[model samples]
Target: MKKSLAMLLAGAMVVASLTACGSGKKETTAETTSDTTAESAESKTVSDGETYKIGVLQLTEHAALDAANEGFVAALDDSGISYEIDQQNAQNDQSACQTIAEKLVNDGDDLILAIATPAAQAVAGVTTEIPIVGTAITDFADSGLVESNDAPGENVTGSSDLTPIKAQISLLQKVLPEAKKVGVLYCSAESNSEIQLQMTKEACTAAGLDVEEFSVASSNEIQSVVESAVGKVDCLYTFTDNTIAAGMNTVTMVANENNLPVICGEQGMVEAGGLCTYSIDYYELGYIAGEMAVKILKGEAEPATMPIEYYPEEKCEFVGNEETAKLLGIDISGLE
Candidate 1:
């Protein structure tokens, strides 16, 4: 009886040990599974079928800005990434830009696309956390949007619509070789305009052409300001000024009535009524910005480190308005 009892106790001990071993194995498997789940969560990116929200704040409604907006959308559509976009236009109003920027921030968008300098400035004023991709902007560092073109050092980076200034000036000289004085027409309110104005003056001076300033504080003053420049200067040169771009009809009309040749900064302005430009495509510029946006979303890059982009110079075209050229009776045959 004693031997049987001892054997039974040993058997019971063995069973208990087996049960404990099974529990230990189960716990180890569970820990490994938990670690793997955490690693997977960390590795997931926007490309992993996660939907992203994008907000676009455009400064105004005009052909150039419109084309940029369209190109940005087209890029996202082609990216095959799931996303929802909220587009807002400021109508060239700074107050409107501020309001829309605040709304976008409160709504928690994954990213924001600022179409112009003012819009970018508005968004930058509101948030430093949200990634900002700007287009139609000349100099990011000069605009205080980024720390540098090579390394943003902040949450802002995008393509610059900085057309070849010297090239445009050369084209102007080619178009009107006999002209001695050029009127630099732009909105004084826009910082970008001021920056371009200074560059234009330098370029004109270097080319032995005198430049006269014709700046307007608002679109309301465009007519009077442009009229004031009609006989004072030989030709009018306007850069990528948003205010002038919005009021191109008035600018071209007044200049045209007086037979003044207006050399524009970009293709849209030339298309609207100006004579010609060594122009950069705003659509292509925006597309470049959009591509940058994709990398940011995919966790493949960060705006703080992404270099500012620009449309290839080789792709820039010398766009001219034949009708405007005909109206002004200028020989653009040399351009062709």
Candidate 2:
């Protein structure tokens, strides 16, 4: 009887100890599971948050550039992406552009948006590692921004406001059908403008019109260059070169004195004082660039792989200044 009682006590003690141990193990497992669930939720919240810093370098403070800058910011705001835009205008100074580019690079920007050819070139010189999205670039390859427009295959990519060069020539020819000699005006330092001058020269030559090239180093040279060419060529034409466009009143004054008609590369150019133009929408160009930037910042697209985009002919419009038309005494009745 004593042994039986002792065995019963031992068995009961073993069962009680096992139950306590099992309960302890169950409690530990529940606590571990609860911790893992909480940790997972915390990690998910951390992963869901994102922030970006964007740097913008604009070449000048002209109407076209200002519009582009506005469009870019508006698009970024509309994307619902958390970001900060650090913007600086170069004021049409090459050295200023370089300084701005260096500052943006040093700030460790997530990306850079260049608003013109000079700004893009400046940013491209700063870093190959930082992606650059450029708008209002006339020629990607000509500007030395990329190896190819398709599959840029490099660190630079964006939209081009390359207005229809040939169409511009056509518009000029329509307005001055009998004009034999056409004078081209632009800034010599602007590679974009140089490209336009060359293309325009070629187009005019092909059209059997004599081409007179007049180049200026800056706005200060505009008066002399225009004065010399205004009376010489039957008509005057210029691209949306920031330098020349900025001093347009001086140019129109000279051209007007000679009763010369002016054809321009953009609406802003015409708004200043030109007969007409086949041009791209500067705001839309910048807006498209902004959208591309969002993709790049989100890691959805790489600048190297992103194809350089261009506006279609439909996006191109014929804009003219009627006030200037009346002043020049040019019959634009057919164009309206």
Candidate 3:
């Protein structure tokens, strides 16, 4: 009986040892898995915490372009991504744009935001490796900045500030029913202006109104151009051309003095003393560009495949300058 009891005790000891060994093995594996999971999470956190360097090249300082820059920065601020920005303005100088573009590229920026067509072109000319986002541009495809609006097929994409030219012409007809001759004025050097001019010509022809075009190479000739158009055309039509937009005061002063109501391309021009416009919100356009930049930075999207974005037509506003209307002795009450 004693021998049997001892044997039973030994058997119980062996079972306990086996049970302890199994429990230890399971505990070790669980601990190892927990440690590995923690390390992986930490690595991911470090990668996400990296700060991005962004460069912004703006064409010139104006109400529309300034608003675009503000909106772009606002988007980046809202994105929760840590970033450093190098903001540079070309002051409407193409050469300055080229210099700034080169500087930004040399600085090794991760991404670039080009405000206008010239700025975008400058940056694109500098680097094909760096991603570029353009805003306040009329048509990316027309400007040769992209292969197509639907598929950029390159490392360039953003929002287009292409306002409704047809609607604008209709507005012009509504405002000035008796006016027969319309003078189209824009900067000849601006590709965006050229596109708008073509659309304006088509729209004017369809409306059965005689249209005349006046092109300026630079802002230096704005005064002379406006004076030349005074007696020939009943109303002057200006586009969102950066050159003309910058010198809008001179253009409007001349037109207002001659009692020729100017139909502007944007609210900034209207506010600067033009008559009216169907204007797109440039700030919203920039915000859209900013969102695209965020997607590119996060690897969520690529500029090569991203289609150019546009503000919805419903978002456009029919804006008129009341003071200018009063000066021109024209009634814009119907616009309200």
Candidate 4:
């Protein structure tokens, strides 16, 4: 009886040993599974953190817009974010801008940067879900991109190249103090031009300078319209209208022939043929847009809450084309 009991006890000990071994194997398997899950989660996080893609739509090859593009790219590079850029120029055509924006949106670009007023309008028409940033836009209100200038109030918000009309008027007074009548020249189709022209007229009224708006529907009309204006107003004011900018040589020729000093809306125009300008750096404005884009992509800010920003300060330059200056015979030494 004692021997039988000892054997049974040994048998129970063997069973217990087997059970302990099985539990150890199960624990090893659970640990392996946990490690696998941890590895999978890490890999997923890495894949999710890949590079970003940005699409840029510029209205034309104008110097100001080109500078904005440069600034944007530079800022992106500075952020150390891997990004792919697709840039297209609309050649100052609204329909072309619309088509390019639609293509970019359809291609699943992560963000869109529209460089001018028309370009911004085109992107706004394409998609509201995708973030649209605008730079070099003259007036957001004039383009109907937003409800108010103080707040963009939409998916679209960015920098404005809208030089203060009062400042422009002040510059005009500095250059042509004795002039009573001023002619504002721009393209009729450009909302930016129209808005700037209206502002000019209002500022002129306040400054006691009679202002007449001269609109050209295309480059073909600029020469004739500017000539007519040259005969009418004592001085000329040119806006950053792409059409007018494209035909700057013609306008300059007409103004120079009539001895009328032309004050420009931006520095590029002044650099091309006008007298002087108080304008913001288009490149700086574009960099500001790039900064906003980084914030959006990182989920740090919402476009609706971020009001469009302006250049911290306007940059003024006395870009007097010596030839144009000589022809107009306007001594701007005081402005210099």
Candidate 5:
């Protein structure tokens, strides 16, 4: 009897040992699963105990781009999203833009705010998995940034600075009705400028006017190109060309010297000395982009589904530069 009892007691001890081992394994798995869930939740929460990193890739340092950056950062602050912004400018160089995009991608930027055409293209080309927000991009379709403007159908979406080309042409015609040939001066490298130039050409053609094109590959050739173009055309029209806008005075002085009036794409250009423009509010455009960013950062929206936004027609206005008008001896009495 004692031997049988000893054997049973040993059997019971073995069963207890196996059950404890099984329980330990299950407990370990449960702990690991809990950890993974916590990690996933943290990743989705931008307001978690972490500082989100934003990369600001600007094509160049200009007033418009600067305003866009300021508006984005200001909105981020207002949204109370903890963030660290790494702002960079490519200085209007494609190679530099490419380099910046690569580095930012490698750095694992949570989101990227591309301020212009080249910068947006550079970043969008590098990766499709990352979210990219464009502020002053002219045409997403023409620029090859997206499949369509209404529904971007890509990982990029933001505010478009596409003001009314017809209205701009009308303002130019109104300001200089007798003008026959209008010079379209722009940087050939910027797709935004090219798109605007083509629109202007079409609009000008429809209005029964002749268009003269003056394109330079870079800013260095702007003055010389303008010198040649100013003689052939009655007036000058400058679009949102980063290279040309960099040397604002170069084109303005060349056009003004030849007694030719200049019309521009935005108020900053006019403020820089060009005559007039039916321009969009660049600040407001930036602010809208900022609001979009807030939606993205808060996990409320995805760039993939966000439609491309445009400045409302009411937000765009016919802005005239009184100083430039005086210098060109153009009467402003008709504008008011």
Candidate 6:
């Protein structure tokens, strides 16, 4: 009977040991689940708390560029995403753009916004991983920024402000219907201006008009170049060349003296002195760029995959500087 009692006691102890082992296994499983839950919550918070930073490189502080910057910032705000914008104006200097790009890359911005062709090229040369959005650029293909206008197919994409070549020619023909020979003046070093010259030459040929090109490397050459162009051509076409646009007073004086009606690529140039122009809304282009930045931040889009966007329709307006118009003797209302 004592030996039976001892065996029973030993069996009871074994049963208790098994129950304790089972309880420990259940607790271990519960603890593991709790740990995984905590880790997931932390990851989620991290993602939610991240604030994006954007670097902006503007080639100059001209009206068009300023409008673009304003539009871009507004669009970013509209996205409901928190971001810090680091904006720098390059003052129309290519070296300044390069320096600004290097600084942005060194600062490790989430993305870069290039406001013009020069600024875009500068940033693109800096880094590939940091996404880039460009605005106010004309002819992504001619700028060498991408392979095609439809699909940039690289780490850079943005909106272009290229007015339709045919439309521009039509506007010119409407304003100066009797004029035969047209002279195109631009900065030789500006690739954007070169693209415009090429397009203008083609469109003028189609319009049964003769087009001649005159190039100025800097501000000092404007007088001599303008005098030569005015002496030869009946009308003058000025592209959105920064150098010439910045020295517009001189261009207007020379052009008006020669009675050469000028048509410009951008509104700012038109306002300064040109007779009339059809241009893209640069501010809207910038706003589109801001929208692109949000997609990059949310990981919803990739720069290499983002196709370059263009304005739905070009915006046309007549500056009608009465004084300048009278000097050119262009019957503004008659043209309409």
Question: Whole-model lDDT, candidate 6?
Answer: 0.78
lDDT of 6 by residue, 1-336 (tens): 999999999999999999998886321111111221111111011224466767788887677888898898888778777665666777788888888888888978899889888899999998888898999888777788887777777889898887766776788888888889988888998888888788888899999999888889987999899988866888888766777877777888888888888887777777788787767777888899889888988999987778888876535544456667877778767543
Candidates 2 and 4 compared by lDDT, better number = 2
Q: Write the per-residue lDDT of candidate 3 for residues 97-141, one digit (tens) a residue.
A: 888888889978889999999999999998999999999999999
| Worst 10-residue lDDT window, candidate 4 | 36-45
**Superposed model 6: Cα runs more than 4 Å off:** 1-49, 314-319, 334-336
Task: Report the lDDT of model 2 for residue 330.
Answer: 83
Give the Cα error of residue 204 in candidate 6, in Å.
0.3
Per-candidate TM-score against the hidden true structure: 0.85, 0.83, 0.85, 0.81, 0.83, 0.81
- Residue 126 C-alpha lDDT in model 5: 97
Lowest-scoring 10 consecutive residues by lDDT in candidate 2? Answer: 36-45
Q: Lowest-scoring 10 consecutive residues by lDDT in candidate 1?
A: 35-44
Q: Write the per-residue lDDT of candidate 2 for residues 1-336, one digit (tens) a residue.
A: 999999999999999999998876321111111321111111101223466777888887777777887787777777777775666777778888888888879978888999889999999998999889999888888889999888787889999887787888888888888899988888999998888888887888888888888899988999899889856889888887989887888888888878889898888878877788888888888888999999998899999999899988776877888898898888777674
Going through the candidates in order, what is the number of backbone clashes in each?
A: 0, 0, 0, 0, 0, 0
Off by over 4 Å in 5: 1-50, 334-336
Q: Tell me each candidate's RMSD, in Å, in order.
A: 10.5, 12.0, 11.9, 11.8, 9.7, 12.0
Query: Where does candidate 4 clash, by residue pair?
Result: none
Please give, for residues 91-127, the per-residue lDDT of candidate 1 as tens digits. 8889889988998788788999999999999999999
The pairs that clash in candidate 6 are none
Q: Please state the error at residue 265 of candidate 3 in Å.
A: 0.8
